[model samples]
Target: MAKANKKDDNVVARNRKANHDFFIEDTIECGLVLKGTEIKSVRAGHINLKDGFARIERGEVWLYNVHISPFKEGNIFNHDPLRPRKLLLKRREINKLEKNVQQAGHTLVPLKVYIKHGVAKVLIGIARGKKQHDKRQAIKEKTMKREAQRAMKI
Candidate 1:
């Protein structure tokens, strides 16, 4: 088992809408390499994974649209907020994601970002885009689940 960091236990950013908007097929954990300033920014909980997605380019996995804000006290050496960052994954994992994403409407969405053992990691999931009606169905199902839980409590 991995030892959890005591202080940064909570998530920095999560695309909750991703769950509602897409059907998640698989999940993969990947390490992100960042500059010192970028790490500082992430450690401070200044990140947005809302519109972030992962892509395979040139046989490598890259995360796009993931925003890590500049350090509060950073100088000229601060990293770019929207720079495309490399994702560390096994070659086998990269091959799998590339295959699945080639299909129509299938994508890799970034679900959450958090600090694990003082390292920044992104939790990305393979997802298929949902239609408008499907989204409504998901909402209806969620509402029923919430109602059932409330009734159980009562």
Candidate 2:
């Protein structure tokens, strides 16, 4: 019975700037704790992860700056657009992320948000900030790769 789902099929929102601003060393999929109205908004693809980042505090991961627009029909029970949401992960995984983030220049960034099997999940990355030169290098490499692909097509 159940049909297989392809990657990116259920992606609701993505932080495209995450890759350009930082180098993602590792990523972990974690569940999100959202209110009923928030979930409704997410299902409608009204979420933004552009300025989102996660922090480990008091042994729990809290996501900040991700904007989940309120449900249009949820007049009285609408959730705040910029509320900090809790991220669910195993204790071991949380510890690992905490340890990595303790290193200088490293931080946690929310990469994308998607619905999997009716549950909302977030892909968080352990990233290190990229310098100006590093960002330029990445851009250059991307342009070269695109040009190469065009040449191959010709």
Candidate 3:
């Protein structure tokens, strides 16, 4: 099935810093392997993707540092907040991503977590780290654009 677009409203969490710290080259949405309580927590918008990242390990993609808060009524069955989760992606895509990430300064980062058709999905990006100068330039451009827009409004 085709992946959902960026404008989808079901987004649960986003890693805003990823945009500022890395240049996203490509994006792939993969299904999540979640437990009962974990899904409940995610549906409740209790997920944090700020520190999350993806790794290709043993021919599979694994997600780390994605926090899914425990379900309030789960009692003893509440899921762990920081457990590593598996991501479902095709073998070909996985291989390509692995190859790209093996290069210097390239990494896999989780861009966002969203619900599509009632199923949880994560949008992972193949990204390259930005230099300090590049980040400063980006910030400068953003400020300039903002100032220009504000000047236009008056």
Candidate 4:
């Protein structure tokens, strides 16, 4: 089988607010432990990562508050819309994340959920909460960059 292209990943959902509200320091791709109906719903773009987060509990990384809408065709077999899911990560990586997260203001936020080679995966970021002033500065910088690009195009 041919390998999937990096740019061709089928993104299920994204948490735009995560970038705006947090200063992302690093990103890691990890697999998700999802059920049949849950994967189906994800493939249908019924997932929401807006309020999703990950935490290390009892030596395991668990994803919380991710909403994967129920599959339309699924009746009793439909999975719950919001359920705490397990994130698959290596022990060393988990330890690193756990350590970094223990620092003040640091947290794990799901950046995006996507399908790679027919497998469900999530891109999670190790981030620190941004202050209101930092958010405003980011917004100003973004606006200035946009204007600069527009000027160059003219």
Q: TM-score: which candidate is best?
A: 2
Quick one: ranking by TM-score, best first? 2, 3, 4, 1
Residue-level lDDT for 97 in candidate 2: 96
What's the C-alpha lDDT at position 89 in model 4? 98
lDDT per residue as tens, model 3, 46-123: 999888899989999999999899999999998789989999999999999999999999999999889999999999
lDDT of each: 0.89, 0.95, 0.93, 0.93
What 10-residue stretch in candidate 3 is worst by lDDT? 3-12
lDDT of 1 by residue, 34-103 (tens): 9879988887889888888888989999999988999989989898899999999999999989998999
Model 2 RMSD vs true structure: 1.7
What is the C-alpha lDDT profile of model 2 across 64-96, one tens digit per residue?
999998899999999789999999999999999
Better of 2 and 3 by lDDT: 2
Report the lDDT tens digits of candidate 4 across residue range 1-154: 9987778458878899999999999999999999879888889998889888999999999999999999999899987788799999999999999999999999999999999888999999999999999999999999999999999999
How well does model 1 score by local distance difference test?
0.89
By summed lDDT, the worst window of 10 consecutive residues in model 2 runs over 1-10
Question: What is the Cα-based lDDT of residue 101 in candidate 2?
Answer: 95
* Model 3 stretches with alpha carbons more than 4 Å out: 1-6
Q: Give the TM-score of candidate 2.
A: 0.95
